[model samples]
Target: MKASIALQILPLSHSADRLQVIEKVIAYLQKQPVNQVVTPFETVLEGEWEELMLILKTAIELAGSEADNIFANVKINYGQILSIEEKIEKYHS
Candidate 1:
């Protein structure tokens, strides 16, 4: 089944630049198969749950590698597509 994954990543160190970290994430994702699903920098992605999880994990790792002193906070929210559709319909009414 397909799912939507939303990731909010923040760097742990105050010295770490936010824009640089975001850029590294975008660049890293661009080189991966996951980029085929959508533009690499998109905050939201729709795909198989397992694939999405793997991509997110890989992205976090890449981000960490770009800055060894950097740390990340990640949150993964999962929902079945039917629930999303129902919510969309409810909001449209």
Candidate 2:
């Protein structure tokens, strides 16, 4: 894969709205071509570099629209990275 990113979107909104915003972002992320691994606190995506960036941008903005503000924690690995499948294969049941 050309890139992989771990994106955590923290939306600063009331409890009622915060979860909906996060779910919205996750739903959008799931539909993309990128391989997505959604954990309790973050979503990891593996795909081509440009594709990943564009998806990340749209997801952040999607959450931002509903929340007062957002705090995003992103960890990016570009070039010669392990595919999401390779990384998690051993852990799968």
Question: What is candidate 1's lDDT per residue for 1-93, written digit by digit as tens?
Answer: 666665545566566787788777766656755423233344555567798788888878877765555555443446656433453567677
With candidate 2 superimposed using the best TM-score fit, by how many Å does residue 61's alpha carbon deviate from the native?
0.6
Q: Which stretches of candidate 1 lie over 4 Å from their true place?
A: 30-42, 68-79, 82-93
Predicted candidate 2 versus true structure: per-residue lDDT over 4-93, tens digit per residue: 999999987664388888899999999998788999999999889999999989998888887878888999999999988898889996
Task: Please report, as a residue range, the 10-residue window in candidate 2 with the lowest summed lDDT.
Answer: 11-20
Clashing pairs in 1: none
Score each candidate by Cα lDDT: 0.61, 0.90
What is residue 28's positional error in candidate 2, in angstroms?
A: 0.6
Model 2 regions more than 4 Å off: none
